[model samples]
Target: MQTVAFTQMKDGTTEEYQFLRSLEHRYIRSLPERLEGALQSLGSGLQGYQISRLEHSLQAATRAEADGADIDYIVAALLHDLGDELAPANHSQFAASILRPYVRAEVTWVVEMHGLFQMRYYAHHYGDNPDGYLAYQDHPWFVACCHFCERWDQAAFDPSYPTKPLAYFMPMLREVFSRTAFDPAILQAP
Candidate 1:
């Protein structure tokens, strides 16, 4: 069928649901391409920085790789700021949600908390509490998040950094997004 017969969920048939599920699976398989497009769009995102948002992401990913991070960490670093254009107020959480289904819980948590941890650098200039991340200091992944912000996210804005191009990370991104979504073992918290 080209489309479902029902407009509402209460009226959907078994066959219709199966067809929709198949369509969804196909769309899911294309997520890596969509994500790459989104990252490319960041080239025109928020201005005023020495480098573009896409460059910042490339720098972060490059730093993570140079640090000997695993595939999950490298991918997470590359995407941590992806939501800046669409969800500027909560970009960290936005990126983390996208990564949650595929990467380990630690990487997801670090991405989620990077925004708060990043405040330690410039929030004081705006008269905001820079130490707000302290609230989560007792959490198991707190230090990880701090390290992520300090080493990858916040430090990636340099114009001179030898950032890798998007093509360099395509295979890693495809591999991560190719994983079965919401696999229990992958989502398990450490």
Candidate 2:
């Protein structure tokens, strides 16, 4: 395919713009594969947990699937910790950003705020407030986020858990990411 020749966006012609957009569409289609690769890499960093980060993530998704979560929710659970390697300080927000355009706002919100919700489980060990999540208690999705963290995220680290392999989720991941981002026809939070 012919490529855009402009060094800057302002100089691009209409044809070039269309070309770039097509390229972007193609690249977006590969998001699921990219996410799977990222999940695989999670095993390389941080070691305090009983299982690898990849394992924890798979277990979380496994549990979510077992609980009959929708594809978007299960995929969200699978990729929720993907940002840990790149943005440990704000991993939840990073993951949420990735999911925001593809999933429901509530799912994105849950992913975004799960880190704080998860703190309720063991934050006291680090001298942090266990009830810090209470700050968001009145939000409509608070209960859902609480369930996500309590039932899936926080409880997914068991070594003996029957976590499905990453390959098991690839098809669902691809389907979730295949959605038209920010589609006006779909319901989403403003």
Candidate 3:
């Protein structure tokens, strides 16, 4: 296992930085497996729902795929709730972080904002304004996010929906997560 010689960033030579970058590159290659483990852990159920969190995620992905959504959309649907275990209040942002590097800005924005859009379904039942989503009614991706919640996330609690297993999505996960950390298409100057 090669390592950087410096203990602090300011002390590093180019050689040490290259070594660290190599290590990071190798580590990133295994991200799909790591994400899968995180998804599997959702089966433990922190707060109960009509279905386990893992099932809800699978159903969402399955729905997205069935609806003829592109691969990025399906993958986003699968990971949209990944942050619930660590940041339930801001899970959409957490999930969006994982997507931002690999996907289109629109896809990332949809993932980032789906939590608020989802609230429209039942927020009023808990005394929160269900129309809170109206705050973003004019944003470009607003309709896409609303459709995501309407067609996939909110409707995914069913236990007998014939949701695909996690293994079925492994290839897509690997392909999506294997991209370079920064996309040249998005980052390069026009």
Candidate 4:
């Protein structure tokens, strides 16, 4: 196992990002809230929002489990879109920055690629050949996600997933909430 230590704050500062260690610490801490925030944000578009992003994340995590991923991967699978709430853009990239602390490279890779893989699945659904999705599944990252999905904590954490009460994400989100990669600093408030 590998671990990185970085200080996590509700709002990040230049000092917080001084080293990879601090960055990693921030990532681990922010994970849960971002998970819930993303779900809530995505689900906001719905009427009753019955099938929330949180639900989707859980389902995706479940799917990852069926596919065979590690706990980290499962957590990644569950919370990959935590950033979709506001940006709906490269939120995973932002998530990567936030999760730098808790997740390993392998787990981070899976989350980073989730949006792309999701697009691949869309393409496959439209005769684009779901192979793209399958190919991702074949990758070690995907395998890790599948294995990770199998774990369920029901409270405190389920492999550090579905982050509850946006507060949790605050700590980790500070690490990766940057507006741009060229400039490594969080632009918005957490």
Best by lDDT: 1
Please identify which of the two predictions, 1 or 4, would achieve the higher lDDT against the true structure.
Answer: 1
lDDT of 2 by residue, 1-190 (tens): 5777899999989989888889998998998888888999998878998999999999999999999999878999999998999999999999999988888888999999999999988999999899989999999999999999988998998999888999999999988888898765543775
lDDT against the true structure, per candidate, is 0.94, 0.91, 0.90, 0.51
Model 1, 24-132: lDDT tens digits are 9999999999999999999999999999999999999999999899999999999999999999999999999999999999999999989889989999999999999
Cα lDDT tens digits, model 3, 1-84, are 366677888999988788778888889999999999999999986766878999999999999999999888999999999999
Off by over 4 Å in 2: none
Candidate 2: deviation at residue 104, Å?
0.6
Enumerate residue pairs that collide in model 2: none
Q: Candidate 4: which stretches are off by over 4 Å?
A: 1-42, 46-50, 66-68, 123-190
TM-scores across all candidates? 0.97, 0.95, 0.93, 0.46
Error of 1 at 50 (Å): 0.9
Q: Candidate 4 lDDT, tens digit per residue, 18-71?
A: 555676657745545545555566555533433555555565556555556555
Candidate 2: clashing residue pairs, number: 0
Give the Å shift of residue 167 in candidate 1. Answer: 1.1
lDDT of 2 at 180: 90
Better of 1 and 4 by TM-score: 1
